[model samples]
Target: MNLPPVNIENIDIKLRFGNFVLNVLYVKFGYFLSSMPEHSHSQGSYELHYIPQGKGTLIAQDQSYPITPGTLFMTGPDIIHEQIPDFNDPMAEYCIFFEVLPGDSTPAINRNHIANDRLMSELLMSTPFWIGTDRENMMALFEMLASELSIQSVGFHHTVTNILEIIVIRLVRQYSLHTSSLHPVPLKTLDDSRLLTIENCFLYQYPSITLKKLADNLRLSTRQTERAVRKQYGISFSEKKAQVRMSAASRLLLSTELSIYAIAVQIGYTSQEQFSNAFKRYYGMTATQYKFKRI
Candidate 1:
């Protein structure tokens, strides 16, 4: 069967936990029709697994965990693990390999206030292995990652990296929920400055930015992100995105010698015709007319 791309490697994400940088070594997604040989990660590394479909068994450290659809687990730092897919219904897997290494110190104020990065790092490292069903419905995010990477649209790299960060946060949240030592915290609303930062994403990443991506960046839920946007800008996310794109289009048309098609592609339109239609709707004139009239 045709699968979304697999064996995605060497992705750089600027997600930090205290002085440690979270490095994504690779990501893989496929169905396991056969058994996987026992494997172990090196020191300071983790392999996060999510099973979106089928049944299987994960053997780790001589313990067996029944893997079902929505199972999310992590094997960390030298933990030997293997997977055995059910022949009747083979397991489909999404795996992310990552490492955390010491880096620059964190700033005094933690803007993404779900938890301090130091605490997050401590919690993640403290657990050597975990197996449980996903409560956050993270399959959607994984699917989004697969789609974005496959399409490689404008700002796709940024979207994928942001989604990875959100996955990390969700993983932390799931861990905190089950652990007795810590509890999950509600995400705080973005302040005006932070909201402005999100607005800047709309300005720069107009081609590929979505409300979901913006929410992931802010570490807030999509609904919360929408509310925050409305509160801060007095406009919806789509409206703001369109405004930014059209404004940029107007400037490029006036200042640059690029053709209409080039301007459309640069501003995120898939086709010149599509861009022309949107330009007319926004400006009430054809792009060529606007350019000649203004010039």
Candidate 2:
């Protein structure tokens, strides 16, 4: 019997941002047969599979679930799983592999007193094994990844890393919303009314995101929005945003070979000198210093 290849080195990327680093192993959109044998992913790795168009049964941890379009499954660490594609029918899907460490934002995690501190820390560790997603949103993200991977163009990996972060945010949002309906108080802590939604928008559009855009989305005055951020996070909106950008910059410095100038442009800084100053203020070291030290 022919077995699917598991060459992780070819596609794997050491993706990093903030306090998070993801070892993205592989992604494929194709047919996978199950006649071979059951297998578990390596320790410290994760596998996310999305069935965009298919009929199959996913057997994991001795439980079986039917797979259909928009079905997304997540497995972290060592968990036995195997896919059984329908014998006679075509099974098409997208599978992603990666490993995340301490899946929390940089300083937010350091501030353990914050409301969502536990929530963000537990995001990847506590992900559900399988989930049903909004078909359109899920498929759009998968397709975008597929398109980028197919092209392997300039900055494709960067694009993929950004989209992967967005995907994680969406998953967390859905999970939190669902859990909130069952238990309201935790959601209230993680989200201050509609403010969490706004925060997620910032995460999705960071670096280039503008306060005016967030205010427009919420139909709130800029001052009102700023007030909400301070109320929720205990910091001004600009400070929080700079933290996010610097987090991204630091990750780029350590993980990628990009120059300080390129990293600055990617994170919305206009000049390398300006970005370098911010880096020093946030990290207490020059970007070049950080990069070489990490090396």
Candidate 3:
């Protein structure tokens, strides 16, 4: 049987998302499911990884970073890297692979250059990595991007690209803020027209969303909205919402110290008992048990 759909709606917003062109290669998140040895990306391909929880090690070009909660790392196309998840404490991270389009804004430079004339070019030239202090915001974006790709909803290709653009821009901003460099990366330029309308809706409203409420927010009839969603993901609207909520709950359970009841309410359930039943149905274990298993 086909699985339930992931929630990945987009909406319009006036943020300076990005100016550089980008093409997404792949996006995914979960436990350590692979045992690939050291590998390198194809030409022009780059990788962005976010480790929301657990501990491990990331080795790139012989440079290593301790993978911990809230760690974000970006690697150039030529860098050789190996992901070593702690065997007993395996990590869960969101990874996106893509390539930046050649353009006038990105200076032509050798991949080995640690510094470049332009800030954007320098970012691409060097291996940019960060362990962020506030992870909730970043994890939410990763969750949404993963949702879009996991479902492969209609128009999801474009939606995934849009979200990745935002992620790249955010990283650039972080790099600029911390690095002491001669060139400053432009932070307010944009090139794509895909708005964050539906994405914002799910990000902010997923906790307590109803089909009718969701339809009204998007300004479409309930039936029309349901049809559109079904056409895109092959699942009912309610199923999609539950999937999103459960996904978020799983993340919070692994990363935060919140109590079961608090997490239940945070994800929009009225009571811990209700959330526990639903969680058990979706994950085949209780929330407390799931948390302990990861510990």
**Better model by TM-score, 1 or 2?**
1
Separately for all candidates shown, the number of backbone clashes (residues 3 or more apart, or on different chains) is 0, 0, 9
TM-score of 3: 0.45
Tens-digit lDDT string for candidate 1 (91-206):
89998876666657546575664257767777787776788879997989999988887777999988988999889888878884333212222132444235345634864577
* Residue pairs whose backbone atoms clash in candidate 2: none
Instruction: Return the candidate ranking by TM-score, descending.
Output: 1, 2, 3
What TM-score goes with each of the models? Answer: 0.57, 0.50, 0.45
Q: Residue 18 in model 3: shift from native, Å?
A: 7.8
Give me the displacement of residue 238 in model 1, in angstroms: 59
Which regions in candidate 2 have their CA more than 4 angstroms from the true location? Answer: 1-18, 33-36, 102-118, 134-136, 176-295
lDDT, candidate 2, 1-295, per-residue tens: 2223222234546554444556565676776553313444333446777777758887776677887767777765445555778876646777776655543455644455454545643565555354665433877887787787777699997897787767765655555322211111111121222543454554556777777887887778889878766554446778777866875676567657898899999989999999999889988988888889845
Candidate 1 residue runs with Cα over 4 Å from true position: 110-115, 176-295
Top candidate on lDDT is 1
Q: Report the error of model 2 at residue 127, Å.
A: 3.5
Residue pairs with clashing backbones, model 1: none
Could you give the candidate ranking by lDDT, starting with the highest? 1, 2, 3
